[model samples]
Target: MVCESNSTQAAARQLGINPKLLDRGQQAQVVAEVGSEELALDPEIRALYAANKWLAQEFDVLKTALVFFGQLTR
Candidate 1:
């Protein structure tokens, strides 16, 4: 309701609360949002590293198979 109000002061008055408290709550919300976004990056980086490791192993297997088939054909 405070977000939809035309003014923070008026919203606080209507709700019978302090404007400063409402302002602090808003500030805390912004900080939490920023913190959450930063924390989210770690998982994404871990997932990429895992994918890279899997691809490297797959390439080594395919290389060995190609060598074996090459020797048989010759």
Candidate 2:
């Protein structure tokens, strides 16, 4: 709601809550709880997670290759 709305206070008001309810501490706690729950996954999601990690590693390698070639050209 905050991302879609022009103002964060307006977003909270539309949700029928105070703007202070969107404080950083509350958001951090919510993220930690959600991340913990999400990581408690079954085998299928675990496979996907492993694949995502591999892809991220491949992307980092590609970025390093780009930098190496860019430096060689200069």
Candidate 3:
């Protein structure tokens, strides 16, 4: 897995949007409205999105497992 220490910058680059534009918490709306258009035009972004989605799902599973096993201390 790639280290995403600068996730916002990476996401902004992949979405072809300015990172500053997302400061107002409008990234979701912007993506929802234009994501398809952008995805169709850029295969790289689509691939990145897919990978990110997979990573997120995997992360969720790991978190759930850790919680179930009581490995994650509060």
Candidate maximizing TM-score: 3
Off by over 4 Å in 1: 1-41, 71-74
TM-score of each: 0.40, 0.43, 0.48
Judge candidate 1 at residue 60 and give its lDDT: 83
Query: How high is the CA lDDT of each candidate model?
Result: 0.66, 0.62, 0.66
Q: What is the alpha-carbon lDDT of model 2 when measured against the actual structure? A: 0.62
Each model's total of backbone clashes: 0, 0, 0
Relative to the unseen true structure, what is the C-alpha lDDT of residue 33 in candidate 1, on a scale of 0 to 100? Answer: 46
| Tens-digit lDDT track of model 1 for 1-74 | 22434598888788898887887676565446446534434556546656887999999888888888895342
- Candidate 1 vs candidate 3, TM-score winner: 3
Candidate 2's C-alpha runs over 4 A off are 1-41, 71-74
Candidate 3 error regions (>4 Å): 1-36
Candidate 3 local lDDT, 1-74, one digit each (tens) = 12233887788798898777654344354356445555534657756776887999999999999989999965
